[model samples]
Structures are given as structure tokens and as C-alpha cells.
Target: MTRPPARPMRADAVRNYERILTAARAAFAEQGSQAPLDDIAQRAGVGNATLYRHFPTRQALLEAVHRDHIEALCRQAKELLAAPSPSEALMSWLKAVVAQGSTARGLAASLMAAIGTQEESWCRDAVFASASALLARAQQAGAVRPDVTVRQLLKLVNAIALATETEPDRDEQVGRLLDLLLDGLRATSTS
Candidate 1:
């Protein structure tokens, strides 16, 4: 059966929710996913009860903080779909995915560790949809090899992120690795 739409938050509840999210973002950024919940509540100027009311668990809070970045990536994909060069757009978005994975450090990893094929999954679905659209567009334009799957591309980019995670000059390393990856995936070559 379909669930009824939930009621809206009251003005103060809405303010508390926004404040909690902002505090959570800063806390997570400063101390990774293991940031103290009490500190977050204090930072939000709310009691622990209020923080719990808004976000029951660390995973939930992490997901909410990461949600904006995920939405940004999805939006970029939609815009890149209109770019003149489909192949370049795909590569550009892939680089962004790596950048997200790289810069977010433990934030995404903690959320991803709890992620599975759950019915209400938002993170995986949004990312897959974004990548799939760019991949399909590039493949259709014959700029990228039709043999490539979004799963494979995601794996490679993730590997690139992991490989360069500890490097002092990560931007250069990621860029170099991406160029090598793109060279291999070019339509002019057969795997």
C-alpha cells in the first residue's frame, strides 16, 4: 500500500532542521564521520533531543550532508548532456565523480559502507543514473566505445580515487590517471 504524504514541519522545527544540517556539515567536515553528536547538537544550538528528532543516526546525518554534493553531480550531468562533445562531457563528469570521492574522504565511504540494494536507496540510484545517462549519450554519439558499461566506468574511476587518495599532489595524479583511462576507452581503439 502507498503511504500518505507526511505533514510539513512547523516554522521552528524547520529552523531546527536547517540548523542541525548546517552544524552536521561543519562537524563532519572538521572531524570526519565520527564527529561527536553532542558537539553537533551544541553547535546547532539545539538539545540532543532536537538533533535526534531531526537525524536519528550518524548515517542519516551523513547522507543528508552528502545529499547536496550528490545533487550537484546529478545536475552537472544534466547540463553536460547538452554539451557539444558527448565524449568530453562524459570524461569531465567522471573526473568530477573522482573529485567527489577523493575530497569527501571518509564521508562518502561511511555512507557507502552502509549502502546496499535497499529499496529506498538515494545515493546509489542518483549516482548511477547520472553516470548512465552520460555514458549512453557518449556511446550513442560513437565517441566512446559501445562496449563500456556504466558499472565498469564507475569501478575504474573509483579505483583511481582510491589509488591517489594518499598522494601529496592528488590533482595531478588523478588527472594523469584519468587521461590514461580515457585513452584506453576511446572509440578509435578496440579492447
Candidate 2:
């Protein structure tokens, strides 16, 4: 059975929703996915009831936050279709994925766990489709090796995120790691 589409929120409800999301984002970034709901409510200047109405559970709030990021990643993948080179576009999206995974100190573990367990996760499906399309395009263009799987690529990206989570210069570390990864994925002379 299909669920009905969500109804539009009233003006104040919309504002509350946005505020909650913003607060949740900052809280999650600062305190991981386990950030207190009351803290989020306080940060958003909303009542605890309001926060609960918007997101009933920590997992629910985490999903909402992740959904927003996944949608952006999907949009980015589509936009990158017009990039000069297929390989470059794929690498760019991969970098974005790494950054997303590393956004919070402990987010990658939660995300990886959710991706593993959430069989009906729409956001995860969208992310996989977007990633697969980019990978396929690069492979078809002969810029990347055909042997690589999207799952493998994602694991590598997440691994990069985990490895650089504590670095003082994470962006630079992630960039260097991504470059090394992309080089390995390149179509080699023997492959």
C-alpha cells in the first residue's frame, strides 16, 4: 500500500519546521545524531511538543536531516551530468558524498547503519540511484574501470570520511584521499 503524500503546512508550521530542521542540523553537527531533542527544541525556540510533532523520534529527525542532504546530492549529480568530463563529474559527486559522511563526528556510523537496515529508505535509494548512474556513465565513457561497483565506491568514500574525521585539516586530507581513490579507479593499462 502506498502512503498518501504529505499535506502542505500552514505558514507558521512551515516556519517551525524550517527552524527545527536548522536547529537539528546544527545540533547533529555538534553533538552527533544522539543530540537531545529538548536541546533542539530550545535551539529552535519551539516547544518540546512542537519538535515531537515534527519528528517523533531521534531516528526520524536523523532521517529528515539525511533526506535533505541526499536530495541535494541527487541534484548535484544531475547538475554534474553537464560537467566537461564524466570522470570529473563522478569524482566530484564522490567528494560530496565523502563530505556528507564526514559532516558530523560520528555521522558516518549512523548513516552506514541506517543504510544497512532501512530496506525501504527512500533517501538511500535515491542516493544509490544517483551514484550508480554516475558510476555507469564514467564506466561507459571508459574513464573508469568497469569492475568497480557502486557499493564498493560508497564504502571507500565512507572509509575516507571515517579516516579523516579527526584530522585538523580534514578537507585537505579528504581531497588527497579522493584523488588517490579516483586514480585507482581509473582505467589502467592492463584493465
Candidate 3:
């Protein structure tokens, strides 16, 4: 299918857009969703007008950041699929999905909020599509259980992120828990 035409942006506008996103991600990582827009604009070295032109509202900016993260996770899934071991690739992608979902203090909640929204559903859909592709590859290789679904895997990853958000001191526990979850998904013959 032919791709739809994207609106052409001037070089300056494109740079401003990228700068805004980078600054917003850092701000959100430090201060959650409550980070000030003006601070983000200052950090980006752009005026409030420029920031507002790119993202009119706080939710708009948050959604954009979340969308960018989801896109990266999707790309990671594709790259992981090229690994020689399907089980290893799936496990690595699962860890990455959780990390992506938990990078910012409130990023997981924002992503959950995007689930039913008209403009933001594409982000959620893209995550699911990428995850399903990885899961299918592992399932076909008899590495993962045939009964497992992408939604279940995604939910589990989200839960892990939420559960561990306040306990950065227990990083090893997080790994063990994630390993346990992955073990459950393993096909009996492989286990």
C-alpha cells in the first residue's frame, strides 16, 4: 500500500520538534508527568511559543514522548528477532518492554491512559503488534507456550514495572521475578 504523504516541515521546525521531545523526556524522567512545560522549553532552548506549537498541552507532550518510546521498543523487538536463540530474543524484548514502560515515573500510567484515546491508540496498537510478532516467532520455535497471548505478556510486563518502581534497591529481585515469569511462558518440552 502507498504511504500517506507527511506534512513537510522546515529544517528549523524539525530541529525544534526533536529538541522539545528530548528535553521533555529528561524532565519527565526527573519529575513525572507533573514536570513544568516552561522548564522543558527552557531546557530545549526553545521559546514557549515554539514548544506549544509542537505540543499544545501537557498530555499532548506526554503522549508524544510515550509514542516515541513505544516506537523504539517496537524497533528493539524487530532487532531481537534476529538473535539466534528465539527464547533469548523474546526474554530480552520482554525486559526491554518493561524498561521502556517504566523509564519515567508516570510513563506506564500515561501509556495505559492512551489505550482508548483516539489520537494515542496508535501507540498502544504499535506496541502490541511488535510484541505479537516476537511472541509468534518464539512460539513457532517451541520456545514459548502456545497458549500464551501477547496481551497477557504485555500486562505481565506492565505489572512488573509497576511493582518495582519504588524499590530500586532490589534490582536483582526484579530480574529473578522477570525470569520466573518467562519460565512460566516456556513450553513444557523446552522447560
* TM per prediction: 0.74, 0.75, 0.69
Candidate 2 has its poorest 10 consecutive residues by lDDT at 1-10
The digit string of per-residue lDDT tens for model 1 on 1-191 reads: 11111568787887788888888778877776789999999999999999888777776666677776777889999999999999999999988878887777544454354343354656677778888999999999888888998767877877787678668999999999999999878888545
Query: Over 4 Å off in model 1, which ranges?
Result: 1-7, 36-39, 45-49, 101-119, 145-147, 162-166, 187-191
Better of 1 and 3 by TM-score: 1
Q: Locate the minimum summed-lDDT window of 10 residues in model 3.
A: 1-10
Error of 2 at 4 (Å): 14
Q: Of models 2 and 3, which has the larger lDDT?
A: 2
Deviating ranges (above 4 Å) for candidate 3: 1-23, 34-59, 66-68, 102-105, 115-120, 189-191
**TM-score for predicted model 1 compared with the true structure:** 0.74
Selected candidate, larger lDDT, 1 vs 2: 2
Which candidate achieves the best lDDT against the true structure? 2
Q: Please give the RMSD to the true structure for each candidate, in Å.
A: 4.9, 4.6, 5.1
